[model samples]
Structure formats: structure tokens, C-alpha cells
Target: MDQEASYGFAPTEFEERVARAQRLMGQHRLDGLLLTSMDNIRYFIGVDSTFWESYTRPWFVLIPATGAPLAIIPEIGRAIIEKTWVKEIRSWPSPRPEDEGTSLVVEAISGLPRRHGRVGAELG
Candidate 1:
């Protein structure tokens, strides 16, 4: 069993949260949501980790208008993140001050459907 499975939210609970977010996204006509904060990511995907303490790596959770949430994270956290409900995970090497998953994030956002898709990000 995965360590996260024991402590994280149940699969159904995660699904409910995702459904609620998707509903709101649809109401607002958003193509997707970009969640960079640890709290927001955990809320959406149930990925609780102390590893977020280090600023060396940035983690992202992209909640599309439909379907499951996608996690864009560092390779170091892959094992732990895999334990969460998020199934579509994209990983990159950490501490890469130059890039730091910037391109990966851009690509992920660009892949969303709709030529003029609107993606919402949590700035605060």
C-alpha cells in the first residue's frame, strides 16, 4: 500500500472535490485551472506532502474543464505523488534554476482544448 493512501483523502472524496471544481469552471467558462500553491493542489488532488517545504522544486496541479486533474511535479516527488488520486502526472528534474518546469507548464496549458481557452491561476 502507498503511504499517501493511508493518510490522504479517499478516492471518492477527491472525485467529489474535482467534480465541484469542474462545475464551477464550467459556470465561469474556464478551460482549466492552474494551481501552483501547495494547499490548492492538495485540495484538488489529495496529495499531501511535507516535501513541499523546499523551494527547490515547484509543484503544479492542472484541473481541466473535464476529466481528472493532472500533476506537474519534480521527479523527486514522483513516488509520493503517484500514491495520490492523480493519475496523469508529469515530472521534471529539480533545482533547475534555469528552466524549473517552465516549458512543461506552458505545454500542459497549451494542450487544453479551445483556441481561446481561458486558464485561471491562483496568484494568492
Candidate 2:
């Protein structure tokens, strides 16, 4: 696939939407959000090209109020995740852990400035 054109599909209005979502998040009193579902993450970040390869790695994205969002993905996605919007990507090599790498997700959520932390999670 031509990343050039396909990726540009949603990047145009992504920033504005992100701002809008952030505002909505604030109004809803959410400290931040953890995105684990592919659809939801794509909706928020405007990039929808994560598919599992030989490995069954889970994909998750975290959007915080103050800083850039983070991407927690399977090792197979390392290249694109790094090359893509989320420069900060936490990876899990296969042989999938029984815990399913929730620890990293939790840690990322923990790092959020949750003083008034009403966190939003996409549990799909």
C-alpha cells in the first residue's frame, strides 16, 4: 500500500479533531484516555493501518492532555509505529504474555497528570 496517499486520508483534519476530542474529554472530566480498540484509536488519531501479522500482538494507543500520545503495539509494527505519528511506542514481543501486556498500558496511564484524573478507557 502506498502510505503516502493512504496515510494522508485523515491526517488533514486529525489535529482539529484531536483538539475537539480533548475538549470533549475535559468537559467530561476525563484526565486522559487509553485507547485499546483499533477503531477507536484510528478514529481519534486518524490513522487506521494497524493489522496483525504472524504474531497476535494487541494494539493500544494512549492520548493524554498535555503531551503527545503513545502507541503500545506488537513487535511487528515497530517500524510503522516509530515512523508514524506516535514516536513513543511500547512493544510486546510475541509468545503473548498471559497478562497480555496490560502492565505497560497501566504504566502509561499512571504517567498521566491525573490530579483530577477521570480517565477514559476504550475497553473493546
Candidate 3:
């Protein structure tokens, strides 16, 4: 591979993953999937970041049942995520624990065509 090639999974790989996830969501009657962890976020968007190590910051990738994945992340990650196949990116100022993107996330979820009124999430 040439040095110019980007890192992480290929664009097509991410597309397929999102497609499969959407299919599963359809079967499960979920309106969307809210991915918060680094692994799950990276899996869909192919964005790897060391900043995820900071316990203070949280990143998200919301995969809707009918469209491309939307990345709700800190503004610092905008540059990195822009390099990926994800087109819809929403970012908030970092270290704002008072809000910490909670509103943005809720707004994104609220706009989805929620037939089942369900959104899948990765919970420990």
C-alpha cells in the first residue's frame, strides 16, 4: 500500500458495516444505534484517536436506520473524522461536562423517524 493511503478500515468496509447494522436495526425494530465507546465508534467511522483515552471526553457515532452514520464528537475530533467516510458530523466544545454533548445527542435522536421509539446502545 502507498504511504498516501489512509489508515483504518477501507471506506467500503465501513459502508458495509453500517448497512449490516441498519439491517439488524430494522429486524430489532430500532430507530437508530448510539455508539459511545471508542471501539464501536471507530468500527463504524474508522476514526482512531488517542484522545479517547481521556476519561473526560466522550465520542459518539449515531447510526440511523435509513441513512449514513452521524458522528457526534468533540470539536477537536472534527479534522480526523472528516477524513473518514462519515459525512454528517456534529461536534461540541470539549470538556463541557455540564452539557457534554447530551443535548446534541438527544436532538439527533429526536429527529429520527422513530416508528418503534427505540434506539440501540452499547451498555456495560
Order of the predicted models by TM-score, top scorer first: 3, 1, 2
- lDDT (C-alpha, whole model) for all candidates: 0.84, 0.70, 0.86
Runs in model 1 lying further than 4 Å from the true structure? 1-4
Number of the top-ranking candidate, with lDDT as the measure: 3
Tell me the tens digit of each residue's lDDT in model 1 across 1-124.
7644653877778888989998899888998999988888877777778877787788988989887888899888899888888888898888789987888899998888863379889976
Predict model 2's lDDT versus the native: 0.70
RMSD (CA, Å), candidate 2 to true, equals 3.0
Global Cα RMSD, each model? 2.0, 3.0, 1.8
Q: Model 2, which residues run further than 4 Å from truth?
A: 1-6, 10-12, 50-56
Residues 1-93 of candidate 2: C-alpha lDDT, one tens digit per residue: 765454544454656666777787888888787777666766655555636433356778888765677888777676766545566888887
Better of 2 and 3 by TM-score: 3
Put down candidate 3 lDDT per residue, 2-62, tens digits, no spaces: 4225536776788889999999999999999999998888777777889777877788889
- For candidate 3, what is the lDDT? 0.86
* Candidate 3 ranges with C-alpha deviation above 4 Å: 1-4
Cα deviation of 5, candidate 1, in Å = 4.0
TM-score of each: 0.90, 0.78, 0.92
